[model samples]
Target: QCTVQLGGSDQWGNITAGTDLVRRVAGGKAFGVVSPLLTNASGTKFGKTEVGNVWLDPELTSPFAFYQFWMNTDDRDVIGFLKCFSLLSQHEIGELEEATRVEPEKRIAQKVLADEVTDRVHGETGLAAARKATQALFGGDISGLNASEISEVFGDVPSSELEKSRLGGDGLQLVELLAESGVASSKGDARRAIEGGGIYLNGERIQDVSQALSIEDAIEGRYLLLRKGKRAYHLVAVCE
Candidate 1:
């Protein structure tokens, strides 16, 4: 008889216990393979985005988000992740490493990592859907998507809905809008943030406090992505 067990790093002690039990009771030696503990560059345990755990199931973590997560992996971790997840041979992996070292902007390792894992968990169809969603998101093209797809892509983004009437002829001031959306705590703070080069609108840096949201700038006629610094992000939805 054989058994398979899957667990995190902390479960090592328990795993050994189970192996010992199997050997003593069944009169057969047991073997095991332990996966490396995933961690961030800071050595903290790896987890999902600030939201929760990274799940292999598409229902739990959408394919697009999963692809983006892998795509954004640090240069330092891409090789290790590729080795752990891809079906590539050792020589192929070595070649990938060489390519990465020689030309990181090519991001060959990261692309392979994203493609293999995405295909495995979400299948080819899902991978294609994810790639399309990613392109629409970063490429500033949103005309082809339906509402549901739009929701799926921006689900985790911090968003605030606004009434269409409120966005009348005079568009809201940038500083006031930032504060109202909780992107910044106060107008003074918002001004400072913009001046400090910490604010972005739709992926482009917005250094002017006088700027206002235009109907043409909305993604899918509803959403706007606002970024603060390198990592903090917010989404704004305009509702009719």
Candidate 2:
């Protein structure tokens, strides 16, 4: 009894075929609404990132990653995504567009897009977990997160294991640790990264390249998080 069928742009021919059949056999007039293919401003198809396609399945993509996906939407694409993916009203979207123009650094539009899409896909409990994990990841406040949450947030990053003894008592030297952990290519590279203020240990910027890391720095007494820049993360797990 529907008068119109909706489909993606690529499915237009098939939709028209169905409508033709419906008119001939069912003796009814039907219309179609073909949504534009979702793409970035560069016209590259959406949903693909360096990691892979952004999946709705939480098992395929953790709630934290899912939320981060939307949060990372490019400034050029946020407005279109808000229109396409968010349930916000036109008035709300217009307001966000204005906010984006006024305060691009605040990222109000991206946050709304992330919140709406993640809430729709993962529900309130999942959204809460994602937001909390995000805050901990970005704010150097892992005290609120546990072992499982830590693992979840660090899921897509490179990870390696190290001997607990190497971190014994006084702990391992930062540059050597970074090189061995593969966060940097070599001792020289690690030192350069640290001196450039591009190194982070468990989300905290490592201003003192001379500092060492011990078991006390591990989250839940087993893991160390390393970041070379804003987005590149590496996990170091301590083993007995």
Candidate 3:
């Protein structure tokens, strides 16, 4: 039997009951350690109960998302968060505090906190993936990223699926594809946007309304990136 169980204070009753049962049934000594629950600056407990949780599972929350969650921590709460979440020495944390005061714009404290926690939770590989995605997304040089990486980077962006066969033969016209994918309001709007030098395909400006999207235009032959403006992105995913 385990000697001790640790949990939040709310589990005190349940843990104590288990301890008692073990003591009486097996004549074993067990202990329960319940501590006050930790909450974010907003008073939401850091757990499954909170909608803003930074999940450990890459499937539920990608490493990029996890990294950004910590990086966006409030300046007021970062020091306290570093204290609770990271294994940084107090001296190191003090140095970070000084850095924060000196250069808050650089966000050194939040960066360090996010890096330490993400590295600890996700390991070197996950941290690398997170940083890579972050740089690609921020730098806008996504031509080299595979479809999976693009999907991870734009998980929340609007997306549409296209049949693999559609990119064959005549291929789908850029205007029609944009209209179908909701990147533009209609074929006319798509043409206008293309002519206005606002429509982009895979980050390149599209000036020809007659352009067609083919499998070769897709990253990994599975995804097409459509942009109506600088910041509006739409993903066209091709499937069998």
Predicted candidate 3 versus true structure: per-residue lDDT over 1-240, tens digit per residue: 479999999899999999999989999999999999887677778889778787898889888899999988888789999999999999999999999889898999998988998899899988888888877666666766778889989877899999999899979899998888888899999989999999878767888889987889998888888887777889888899
State in Å the error of residue 29, model 2. Answer: 9.4
What TM-scores do the predictions have? 0.62, 0.69, 0.81
How many pairs of residues collide in each model? 0, 0, 0
Scored by TM-score, the top model is 3
Shift of residue 173 alpha carbon in model 3, Å: 2.0
lDDT per residue (tens digit) for residues 74-160 in model 2? 888999999989889999999999999999999999999999999999999989999999987777666678878888877767999
Give per-residue lDDT, candidate 2, residue 16: 96
Q: Order the candidates by TM-score, highest first — what do you get?
A: 3, 2, 1
- Residue 179, model 1: lDDT of 95
Model 2 clash pairs are none
Model 2 stretches astray by more than 4 angstroms: 1-6, 18-33, 46-52, 155-158, 165-179, 182-217, 227-233
TM-score of 2: 0.69
- Where's the lowest-lDDT run of ten residues in candidate 2? 44-53
Off by over 4 Å in 3: 18-29, 55-60, 89-108
- Count backbone clashes in candidate 2: 0
